[model samples]
Target: MERGDFTDLPGLGKPLEDLGPAEQGHDPDWWLKRLVEREKITVLPPALQLRRDDAALDDHLDRLGGEAEVRRELTEFNDRVRRVLYSTHGGPPVTTPPRDVEEEVRRWRARREERRARRTAALAAREPEAPPPSRRGRWWPFGRTGAAGPSDG
Candidate 1:
């Protein structure tokens, strides 16, 4: 189906392709109603349902780690789905604008540098100064003080 067709389904705020193939084939209203019915059957407290859903999502994310494209697409899909579902359910919106990644990277680098500095200072504080080498009989092998040359002459 075309992307625009998804708009005909109730509470589906974005294109079908964004939600992954599994959700795209199903009607949004039908899925929402099924979810509601499941909640009713179990009579789970809303908080518990949210916790369970979050745990499932975390497990899925763990499985998807190191899959960069899948991770990015899934994150986008989750954000879109959450916004649509929460809005339809009359809850506070869970959506936020995308972050400024450059700024975030700068902050991360600064924090890393601070941590490195602290570790280096702690190591220096615990370490003792190295002792000087003994010089009584040690001689450079290539210097003019070689033992064989003058003695043989």
Candidate 2:
């Protein structure tokens, strides 16, 4: 896989000094440090200069932890939704059903309850595992580091 140019990243030329206490998990400075330290890119000058001082870094860590929590919640929600979808309608959903509104409603409610119960049981059987921490972040730094580019200092 070929890495591309850093300038081509989603946000470029902008320094990472804007991180605030509340923006924790989304710390641009932390993200930059991660890339420099983890990705082993030699040419690009480490963006350490942009590191937020004072209380911002602490908030950033808190934000990162919250991100982990959000991910867990999202995964559980997705699993339950998928289970409900698959269980309630084993086959492709009927586009047009009989006009018996009351009967259809009754059947649907029953199926939904059954599917939800099964989902609860299945989810309880196992817990979601978080993956290893990755240095990569919103910034997509790429392409030919240590190439004596202009940013190479």
> lDDT per model, in order?
0.54, 0.47
Q: For model 2, how many clashes?
A: 3
lDDT of 2 by residue, 21-88 (tens): 55365664777777787899655211221122212432333333344453454344345444544455
TM-score of 2: 0.23
Error of 1 at 86 (Å): 8.6
- How far is 3's C-alpha from truth in model 1 (Å)? 68
lDDT of 1 by residue, 1-153 (tens): 666866677757655443446735656587666677778767544334444555454345444424454446455645655555555454444433333434534444565567679999999898687898777533664565645654322
Q: Stretches of candidate 1 above 4 Å error?
A: 1-87, 129-153
